[model samples]
Target: MSLVRISHYLALCGVASRRQASRLIDSGRVTINQQLATHTERVDSLQNLDICVDGVAVLAPQDKQYWLYHKPIGIDCRLLISDPSSLIHLLPQTPRLYPAGRLDKDSRGLLLLTNDGELTQALMHPDFYHTKTYVVQVDKPLTPAFLTQMAQGVTYQGAQTRPCCIRSLSGFDEGDTFEIVLTQGLNRQIRRMCQALGYKVIDLLRTKLMDVELGCLPENTMRPVSAAELLSLTQLSELTSLS
Candidate 1:
């Protein structure tokens, strides 16, 4: 392993993101070989150095795991131990894992969970423009103008969202459902955009993320991401890094 910054090393060990790891080091909670870690310290795990966070030892996981989960609605995405609504309790037992992206509490969808920090960082970065697809049902009948406005781009809270691909999904008697694909993940983006257009979202569900599809995965269930999918993700990450 090449030398990496202390924060990056900690993130690779699944402690937290690089920024959070820096905060831990700054607060004197991180130590390398029993000495307080420094922001400028670079570490290589091959040196057999002792890395501890809050006196608990952390090691780079030898078997990095990736999983796709159907995140049911009303579950917080955080891994908070104290919050009963957090999805951490529902996940399978494994090395500490983190979400590559997030789905808001009120929305249910496909979520990617993995212990690979570098991959998570790459996938979540705005510059990557990874696509996430969602199916939404609103409180009123659908209109051509509404679809056009959403597809064109909506300005909400002073920022115009990127233009997205959206089309109505027929079959529901209510006839107000639409499928939308967005390359940007904003906070409650769909709900906010709908609200800005004087519409209330009735229900929202994510069906796909990047190259992975929700498919027939039952709600509240999870499965290991396939080897082929993992290869694709790693290749995409590498390509983005090079770009």
Candidate 2:
């Protein structure tokens, strides 16, 4: 039988990050086979071990599934909840597929869902600096000064954001539309950036993540990622790794 560290096993099962798993064990929230577990403990086989975290049982995924979902505005991305409006409930039932990254309830567009924890970690890691592009509509026309401030970075929540690319797009009826590409996925970063410049975002739609695009996928629909797309994404993450 093969053995694996408890934390590593938890991460593999999409329970949490390795560090967070350690904390969970230290806090006495994890159990193995009806007994409390420790961080240094090893499980002979994940399939044979009965693991629970905070009263919720977790099982390693037998197969990894990747999906490209068009998250409609107002749907919460958190899949753990039983709310019918959550993204998870909208999609066909599968084994514990989580969002690689989050899009807020008010924002809409391309969101990735997968059961591969390693891939999720790599895609969400700050070091990879994966690009997420958004088309934002603000209540007012975007001025050169506002665009410059965004591209140069803005101070939000006591830290200056990384410099990003921003350009105006035409053909909006009521408000100005602009495309912004960001490497960091801060909470509501685009909206906060506009708010910092005295503008309110009326609509936010993620258009692309790395090579994946929302395309013409209807709202609230999902489809399996093609093999070519997954291969390209993995390559990009490796090339941009900080370690």
Candidate 3:
């Protein structure tokens, strides 16, 4: 019997990322063969262990799936009891998946949804340092000092942000439009950074995540992750280490 960590098994079943699965186990939500499971415990995959979380049986591992969506502004990535505009309502019911990272309801752009929990963990973990690109519009005109300070890094909420690449976009009629590439995703990071610099973000749109791009995708649409894009992501050091 090939024994595997329960967290790995849960991740394979798309229950959650490995770390999150560990949390679930810690909270006494996971069971194997009707016995409570632990994070360090392993089970034989070939044995077809009766794994349950909160009394719901976990289905066998399914083929990994990946998708990219152009999230529209005003739509949340979460499934909230009170919010009717959550993105989950628009997605198909089969092949359950979760968003790799969240985009603010006020922000519109690319979001990756997948059943690959390992991939999700790799992308969301700060140590992986995956890059996301965004085009932002602020409430006022751009200043050289503002651009330089933003690129250098901004201190906000008692923590300093990592240095990021920022470039002003010319020829756009929008006031103070610029593109920024970030490796770390904090809560409302771009908006918070701009606010700390005395600039209010008028619009924020993410165009890319890692090697995946939102190119030409219409708003409120989703597409399967292309083979080339998946290849690029898997080739990254962080993902390769997962093997």
Q: Model 3, poorest ten-residue lDDT window? A: 234-243
Local distance difference test, per candidate? 0.86, 0.81, 0.86
By TM-score, is 1 or 2 better?
Answer: 1
| Residue 22 in candidate 2, Cα distance off native in Å | 5.7
Ranking 1 against 2 by lDDT, winner: 1
Which residue pairs in candidate 2 collide? none
Question: Which ten contiguous residues of candidate 2 have the minimum total lDDT?
Answer: 234-243
Q: Give the TM-score of candidate 3.
A: 0.90
- Tell me the tens digit of each residue's lDDT in model 2 across 1-243: 568888878767766546556878999999988889987798865466688988878776457778889998889986656687787677555466778889999999998887666677677778667899999988887678888999999997787899999888974444399999999988888888788889999999998988888899899888889898899877764664446
Model 3 backbone overlap count? 0
- TM-score of the candidate numbered 2? 0.87
What lDDT tens digits, residue by residue, belong to model 3 across residues 1-243? 577899988887887788778988999999888999977788776676799988889888888888899999999987553679887787666677778889999999999988788788788888766899999999988888888899999998898999999999963344499999999989999999999999999999999998789999999888998999988876773554664
Instruction: Tell me each candidate's TM-score.
Output: 0.90, 0.87, 0.90
